[model samples]
Target: MFGPASSRSRSAWRPRPAPAARPGGVSPRSARRASGSEVRTPGSPPAGPAPRPALPRAAPPRAERTMPQLDSGGGGAGGGDDLGAPDELLAFQDEGEEQDDKSRDSAAGPERDLAELKSSLVNESEGAAGGAGVPGAGAGARGEAEVGAEVSAGPRPAPLARPPPPVPGWPRPALPVPWGTHPSDPSCPGPRAPRPSHPLWISPQALGREHASQRLFPDKLPESLEDGLKAPECASGMYKDTVYSAFNLLMHYPPPSGAGQHPQPQPPLHNKASQPAHSVPQLSPLYEHFSSPHPTPAPADISQKQGVHRPLQTPDLSGFYSLTSGSMGQLPHTVSWPSPPLYPLSPSCGYRQHFPAPTAAPGAPYPRFTHPSLMLGSGVPGHPAAIPHPAIVPPSGKQELQPYDRSLKTQAESKAEKEAKKPTIKKPLNAFMLYMKEMRAKVIAECTLKESAAINQILGRRWHALSREEQAKYYELARKERQLHMQLYPGWSARDNYGKKKRRSREKHQESNTGGKRNAFGTYPEKAAAPAQFLPMTVL
Candidate 1:
């Protein structure tokens, strides 16, 4: 593989070689020195391949500022050549590198000042791997002979090159407890694992994508996101995309059918008026109010006692007598009722009040009124009837033929009335109430009979027999829970304040004391909750 000695006597298949050193043993670099008069031996190899062009001098390797003349890293591929570089060449490299250092230091001075920021949040003393040096600068790699720590004659080894820390000025994770510092892992510890870095928030686009996936694939997801999020919470968050319709990206539609159009795909016509008459209510709106996903998890008294369905029809109240004292004297046989039940008083009375009564004796069970419109008193501005609340009749529905009865109510009206009857203030639970509430479901689930009334009796007797200390503990828990409730529902005060005026007027006619005995604690029962406002509806 050397000069003319190699590949000179080639095989017939090989190309003829160009002659070298034709008149003298010379090459291009030395050709200038070779005169035409010079001669060469026939067997001598042509001058060795002309010296390869001197490589452009390499940029000096980065150096650390510490007291080392060598880097931990060795010369990468050509360690031997680096060791044998000429003395002058090595000296030149040293000069160049020193100049580069001066230039970089001077230039980076202003940049470093600008880079330094005041972030009190990040502790400076812990993990101090950044912010004091130029980027990409490091201890220059030198031969082992010049590595100060190992070499007897060399200068001291430089400080270890530090990695850049988390980019300055961006918030970093909360500082972790150092190894041997955490209280729980006290024994057999070396270095502690770094604390997990929880991002305060992800980018909106990424969050939105996750939310969309969860919304579209609620029960059967493509993949579980390992965000350490509480299970299934993001799946139905109130703030997540609430308006994902038929066109959102994650929502898929069926591919267009190629099976051809149906000849009679149109639906059959039905009487629209009767469609809702017997619809079974699509699992009842009551199911929506249940905390249990399945409606049957709790007793009927707990979940089904309120909001029970009522027929839409108004009841026959022709036999109902008014609640007024009989000594007021004989009243008229004909009275009136508000058609929409009642309306806020204004000029436009879309509904009229009328109820024709049957002939009545002086002491008839049904009472009459000359001014039933004013019977309840001045507070009620619209036509007043025997009813507490009346359903808004449809514009086209048949009118009720009977007199108004306070107990007669439609489903919607009954719901409104029940809400009205609820107490405005949340009654603080006693030990018994809390115990019963907690254990009621347990009893229902465990008992063979599963009768709510039977469960209630057992609970009542058990509660009476509970030790005072045990009861006190539960009572304290209930108090804390109630406090937490107030914290979570700060606006409950506003809900409790609703319908205060109506309550006052309704209570005005009642007696102060009941004939029944007070509770064992000598406390009176609480009054009803805030009344649900029965907003008047339009016929349309």
Candidate 2:
């Protein structure tokens, strides 16, 4: 038999022809080359492509016909020939893709229309409800209407073609809509197909750095139609009645009786930067809102045609609030009750000293700091001016003198004095002390123990049984307090606190000698009364 190596020797080399150039710029030779296909010389019949090595089995396709996709191009039961000409195959593939796109877009149409309908409904409700504006604030109301019109007038973006639909018979997942939205309602448009969620790709580090940046300003107030109407020019024309400057109205208005005061000519209503209608300038909501300027009449000229005494038929809301619906012609008016004088009126109240006349000084007066006594003093140099004495002996007089023995004790003092002056150190409370203090009243209330001595004995037993960790917690607290104590009272010793007790005891010992029973017989000059004879018999 031939040797195994000889039988397996490599086959002889074969040459491939260059592809022919065609009008379509594609050739059969190039197509086979691109597809990685091999062929024998032309004189020999070309062999059929060897059966493709079977691929690992895949799951079967869904039974129902739906959208087409790139992956299914070759795997389907029917397909364009694998060895077909490149240009023809490419043309077929393009047509298939276009058909899939059309089918997907048709399915997605209803969903887009639904979303737009919902947004429109929300904008309409907002416009209809209006804002916090009062009944007849037309400027504020008009602003809202314009905003709603713009929203309704906005152009919609074109719908894009989708790639493909999901496998048929799969359960679709639901998404949450914003509050008050009705997705499935027949009145609202339904989407042709579900829209896919697209996620944004932001760097986490960048997001964190932005979050760490310092806050530069407060959040701006939400803009509303009412916000733009705050400008005096916008609001000044709202009311039909005349509005007068309060100060001028009070000063220049004629009294109830006929008087001959000439009315002051009013200044023209000009939009001068020097003086604005409102004391504080109002911020405009948007630049465009004020594009058209209209004449804003001054408040004083608004209602000159209507006189003050005329009665109104409707409710009067001149006050900031509305009047209660009660009786007609019940206009609120000021009542005058004779009030007693705030201070008693006496004969001395008849006169007040008039202000001094101005001198011929050239400039405005500057305050003089000279004392009244200095102003009245004469040149006669007598005894030094009497020292000013205090009006009362105040408790703060002690502050004038240094507190006795208040300075920290010095080492130079004798041992006896130093020991006597040492400050008393209050014993720091341990965990047991705190526990007992808190529980003493509780124990009494619960009737667990009546006597404090019994409670103390039980508390001691419990404290001894406490775990090391529990005991350490309280010890740490006490240690902190001890450190604080040393800082506050650096030089104090025990003797200072106990010394007061010893001093009181010494004083009481000396006083004891003066307070005993008096002697029965008179020791000094005073004569004792003669002893009275006693009757022995007792009265029955």
Q: Which candidate is the best by lDDT?
A: 1
lDDT tens digits, residues 21-72, model 1? 1211122322221111111111112332111110111221111111011221
Cα displacement (angstroms), candidate 2, residue 62, comes to 84
* lDDT for residue 135 in candidate 2, whole number 0-100: 18
Question: Per-residue error at 144 for model 2, in Å?
Answer: 98
TM-score of each: 0.18, 0.16
List all candidate RMSDs to the true structure.
Answer: 42.3, 46.9
Candidate 1 similarity to native, TM-score = 0.18
Expressed as tens digits, the lDDT of each residue in 104-158 for candidate 2 is 3243232232223222321121122223121111113122211221112121010
Worst 10 residues of 2 by lDDT: 279-288
Which candidate number has the best TM-score? Answer: 1
Q: Count the backbone clashes (under 3 Å) in each candidate.
A: 7, 14
